[model samples]
Target: MPKLTTPISDEEIRSLKAGDTVYLNGIIVTGRDAAHKFMIEHFIKKPVQPDEQELYDDLKELLDGGVIYHCGPVVKTHDDGSYSFVAAGPTTSIREEVYQADVIRHFNLKGVIGKGGMGGNTLKACAEQPAVYLHAIGGAASYIAQSVKEVLGVYKLEFGVPEAMWVIRVEDFPVVVTMDSHGTSLHDTIQAQSKEVLVGLIS
Candidate 1:
């Protein structure tokens, strides 16, 4: 199992092949539908507004050679204004397909974590941007939360806890490289195989 740390280089990302089991040890941001849309609109499609500059700068730095998780985690807020993960399962990734390719290219992201793999645009971005899409196990929220070592900060709490962009530090965060920079997509392979089997049965 390859273990990768944050600020992973494009070279490091390219070394990974589809079906590789990997563990991540560093910072990752949680972003779901609202967060993805907001990022595209505020940071990618248009000029960064004055008030959004800080968050934009922070995200730019963090996402540079970094990873984003398609997750809406359950979290607990402490009295000291800190937070912790209660459940950290990955959400379906396809919903972000509209914006994910651009996000990867714009932010220089090396990896994306989620379940239910993404579409062709994301696969192309992964190949062009030298990024990979990692698949986390679904229905294992509580189990996955155990890998979340700390909550560093969050943005857009107004989007609600799940849709908020939560910065988290993780250790031994397990995932599989379902899509690779070399243009291999496990999801596509599976779908093709399934379709062939269905056609064979019907014929």
Candidate 2:
């Protein structure tokens, strides 16, 4: 399997095709619903406010040529004020479809990790921005958390743990390319094929 590490380039991202199994190694940030909306409204749709500027800079540095995981991890805080992921399962990605394309474009993201899949807008962003949608296994929260090697930091704890953006370093993190930069989406393909089978059965 191809191993994707930090500083991943657009060429590297575009080289991946749907159904390819890959291992990711590097810094990734986890973001869910609240994080996404906050990013869009506070960072994308409007100019960054003075209070939010630091966060915007941090996220911009991390996300450019980096990956974002659609995860709301169960975390364990150490007595020393550190954190670790107990369960890092991916959340459903479709909920962020409206904001995802913009995020990818604005952040220069190379990949998106989540369970299930996204929609046309995300697919278009993948093609145009030269990014990919990586599918992490669902119901394997504990197993997935094992790949999280370290918790670098976090943002927006006010949104609560689940919705907060958790910065982490991962090693050999496994995922499948369900949506590639070439406009191929396994989710769309499967749905179309399933529809064909259903029509055949009913006819």
Candidate 3:
């Protein structure tokens, strides 16, 4: 399997193709529906307020050349106030279809990890921004958590565990490239082929 790391370069992202298995290392960020909407509405689209400027800066620093995981991880809190992931499975990426493209561009993201693939907007954003969409095993939450070496930090805890933004460090995190930076999508091809097969059977 190919290896990927945070702060991934444009060259690295462009070299990936659909169907390539990869192991991701270094740092990744987590977000879901609420986080996505917050990023777009509060951070990216409008002017940052005095109170939010700090948050905006922090997000910029964290997200630069990083990977975003579409996950609502199960976390455990220790007595020392430290946190750990119990299960970290990829959520259905289509939920963020409305905001992903803008998020990628605004954050300079290189990769996205999720299941069920994304749509045309995200595909176009991938092509334009030279990013890749990686597919993690949906049912393999515990296995995925094994790769997360540390829980670096988190933001927006108000949204609760599922919607909070989690910053994590991972080692040899496994995923498959389903959408490549070159505008190639395994999901799209599979869907089209499936439709064709259905039509043939009906004829």
Candidate 4:
């Protein structure tokens, strides 16, 4: 229940433990499996397109050093070339294990936003890279989408919607950082501690 001062740094996130709370007011991005596949396909091959960097860069600057949410929002594009988000459920964090570390490293991201906590490899990657993992509240995508008032833009039509990169403008998106850069995972640690205590009393 400590008070956090201004400009919370990467080092500060490492010392945070389970049940610790933080208030953040920074930019965050949304990406999912489609986006990941696109990145990996281009990364593995020569390149998906000559302007791949441009595709990523167009919205990445706003995302770098900020959080990236693992979400593939269901949006409705209007006839006038505008769109509105209908549903925005969070995708599983485990699915991103393949490239989460790479994306974090490449973009120098500060934190990751998703539903469930990731595995050991991701935990270690977070520690070494000085980033954090966040858990979003479930069953609240409709409310969450309301927070997004405008659609800034989209990237890579070749990938298409769901896979095509999108840039949105949100009013106040809510989230919580559940893992930090010091190998502290709220999900892992809590499960272990709970199991030990329950077994001890029952035995």
TM-score of 2: 0.98
- Please list all clashing residue pairs in model 4, or write none if there are none: none
lDDT of 2 by residue, 1-203 (tens): 78999769988997899999999999999998999999999999999999989999999999999999999999999999999999998999999999999999999999999989999999999999999999999978998899999999999999999999999999999999999999999999999999999999999
User: For residue 28, what is the lDDT in candidate 2?
Assistant: 96
The residue-level lDDT of candidate 3 at 101 comes to 98
> Local error of candidate 1 at 104, Å?
0.4
Indicate the TM-score of model 4. Answer: 0.78
lDDT at position 128, candidate 1: 96
Q: After superposition, how far is residue 139 of candidate 4 from its true place, in Å?
A: 1.8
lDDT of each: 0.94, 0.96, 0.94, 0.70
Q: What is the lDDT for 152 in model 4? A: 69
Query: Candidate 1 has which clashing residue pairs, if any?
Result: none
**What digit string (tens of lDDT, one per residue) describes model 4 on residues 80-113?**
9898888775778888888788777776677777
Regions of candidate 1 where Cα sits further than 4 Å from its true position:
none
